[model samples]
Target: MADIEIFTGPNCGYCREAKRLLDAGGYAYREHDVSQPDAQALMRARLPRARSIPQIFVDGVHLGGSDDLAARLAQGPL
Candidate 1:
């Protein structure tokens, strides 16, 4: 299985959708809520240019946000 990590924020629809997609695909993932201080710092350290919630990492590869994740899922299996 791939190592999946998702950075999410409170009340984020995209974050929920991203998690749904992963769940539907039967992928196990670790979710980090940026609402917490530690997760926020970790997200900033990993993606300095990203200015959105629901940032996703697949096996250490940046997969952008929910839309990007959808596109990736459409292409094939992750």
Candidate 2:
């Protein structure tokens, strides 16, 4: 099992999808809502290349956005 971290924002379908996938897979993760104060800046500081919502990290390793996560899921279980 790996520690998962997912960055999210309000009303983002990608965010919902990411959470949904994690839920379906029974992956317990830390969720960071970028809509909160300083969250966006925190995300930027933590993930400089983050260009969108639902940026996922697996055990501190950058795994990218929702589509990236989906592709990874298609490859195999984490």
Candidate 3:
């Protein structure tokens, strides 16, 4: 089993969708709410270039945002 991480914000629809897709696919994930101070700091440290919510990772690899996930899902499993 691979480790999955997702950085999210409370009001972010894409973040919700990302989680939804993960649930639908039966992929377990650790979610960090970047809206929280500590989580925000950690997210910035890990993904300095991420400009939006729903920043996702699998086994420690950055995987962009929700649209990126959708495209990847289209291809196959994440």
Q: Between which residue pairs do clashes occur in model 2? A: none
Q: Which residue runs of candidate 1 sit more than 4 Å off their true CA positions?
A: none
TM agreement with the true structure for every prediction: 0.96, 0.90, 0.93
Best by TM-score: 1
Write down the worst ten-residue block by lDDT for model 3.
47-56
Local error of candidate 3 at residue 37 (angstroms): 1.0
Q: By TM-score, how accurate is candidate 2? A: 0.90
Clashes of each: 0, 0, 0
| Predicted candidate 2 versus true structure: per-residue lDDT over 1-78, tens digit per residue | 889999999999999999999899988999989989777888999988768888899989989988998899889887
Predict model 1's lDDT versus the native.
0.96
Question: 1-78 in candidate 3: lDDT tens per residue?
Answer: 668999999989999999999999999999999989999999999988777899999889998899999888899887
- Clashes in candidate 1: how many? 0
Question: Model 1, residue 11: what's the lDDT?
Answer: 94
Per lDDT, the best of the predicted structures is 1
* Every candidate's lDDT: 0.96, 0.89, 0.91
